[model samples]
Target: MTSPSDPIVLVGLPGAGKTTFLAALWYALNHSTDGGISLNALPEDQAYLNEISRTWRQGEPQPHTATAVFQEIRLCVRYDGADVPGELVLPDLSGECFQQDQWADRHWNQKYDSIARAASGVVLLVHPDAWKGSPRIADVARAEQLIEGSVAESQGEHVASGGAGRAGADESDQVEANVVDFDPLRVPAQVILVDLLQFLIGDPCFHTALRVSVVISAWDLLESRGRTPSVCLEKEMPLLHQFLTSNADRISCQVFGVSAQGGPYEDPRVRQNLLQMDNPIERIQVRDADGNTSDITAPILWQVRDRVVEERECRGIS
Candidate 1:
């Protein structure tokens, strides 16, 4: 199960905290990394890992990934009491590739196709504040009324002028402009995610019975309001929650609330408090469906180790 071609994939929108989570996971793995999951060997390429982890430990903000950047990370990792380590390959792709380029515009890249075909598991990240909900019924009704009034006024002008050719053309253009052009970026978060998952399941080359880790980043904001990861999913994004629940046979999922930076680093007080901590690992918090944990590797470990073992056992592999 550990190979270059078959890897666990990370998917999310820009600013969804995928990069931050990776940095925290790298830091957590190196400190008190035993008793759960630990890195067996670092990848030959440590430049990217070093840079991001440095910012994470220093309480500095991680730079947003440029849309054109696509980094593949390979970590040789092992779970406690496992016979051998597994190579966890992660493609740290730009979120735009998923939402804007692929799903929205249908500008599918062959590279993404290869990655999707070979992915063994998926970590889907979502920022709570980034959700773009569907337009309200009242708002839609109001827009329709405005368009109708404009058309009626245009018709009255046409009769008064008896041959308002240019005026009629301008009114037609206005009406056409008023007709909302679908912007792929504005598609509801849940809608895109659902469509993404459906693509995975429907595609013939992709693996079936996939395990997914739904991570809600910046969990500190929502945790303060006494919301668990599972509850947050159900309430905040019912469409995604229902889709996952309904398709339980095709995909098994676990929701995690990850506060990779503990709190927003933009806050001076928060940054100061984090800097004061002797161990920056303490600044990381991971909430499972059940409870909280300090291990930032929980989600990846579940995907690369736990599920891999389960799959092997079911096949009677000794």
Candidate 2:
């Protein structure tokens, strides 16, 4: 049984819809004009909390400019037949953080190491696009290099390691050392992949033994492509299941088709422009980005809740 102090961490690549998912879940949980979840809250950095609250209140639908800024929310939830106040910490780091060489270094890894240890488990968000592209060889190499470098540095054997037992070396430092020692080749414990509209298909062996959940975002686009939820899932499930069975004997994964946008936007033209824009600066064009009036909140929240419950069951957590 997790204590009220335990928190859930959402880890994903940038653009994997982490923020969107969090926002949707936040709106559902609060369901009030006052905004924000309050119950037996876990302790958090007050200044950081205030910043995120302010940003959400501003209510602009702009994409995040930086992914390194950590955003979190706490809620009083009923779990295991008990009221346990839990926190959800969503790091602002982009999907790139997972493979970025710069942040894989000692300093960046140190920060993430601390956060990772504090959380009960992680919800890793991967992009489906990753499966289509030629496996990211460069990214793999970079990650390996970073891991080696971090390990060496933590052990005071790397070229960068100098000061011995400095005041800065403490829990966070120890955590960093532990993470540095981790073998990246192993599968993550809990992972979720969020695709714009694609479902997990092709192979089940790819996700064997791991608890996996597939989030299909941008449901509106699937309709635009002339597909229904049932049709999409039917086409994808066999492949996903087959792959999982082949890869791991103790795997539990599920497919959930969701639409972060809920439905087609009121102004289709704006959606077109936003989708077609290749440059972020170009996206600022007033003519570009249109707002939608569709209420996707209910459906999106349902999927999230279901997935949370499903994940808990899969992990044998009541």
Q: Which candidate number has the best lDDT?
A: 1
Error of 1 at 296 (Å): 0.9
Residue by residue across 201-278, what tens digits does model 1's lDDT show? 777765457778999999988888888899989878888899999998888899999999999888999889989999
| Collision count for each candidate, in order | 0, 13
lDDT of all predictions: 0.81, 0.41
What C-alpha lDDT, on a 0 to 100 scale, does residue 270 get in candidate 2? 52
Q: For residues 273-310, what per-residue lDDT tens digits would candidate 2 score against the true structure?
A: 55454421222201101222223232222223544555
Q: Look at candidate 2 and tell me the lDDT of residue 1.
A: 33
Pairing residues by index, what is the TM-score of model 1?
Answer: 0.83
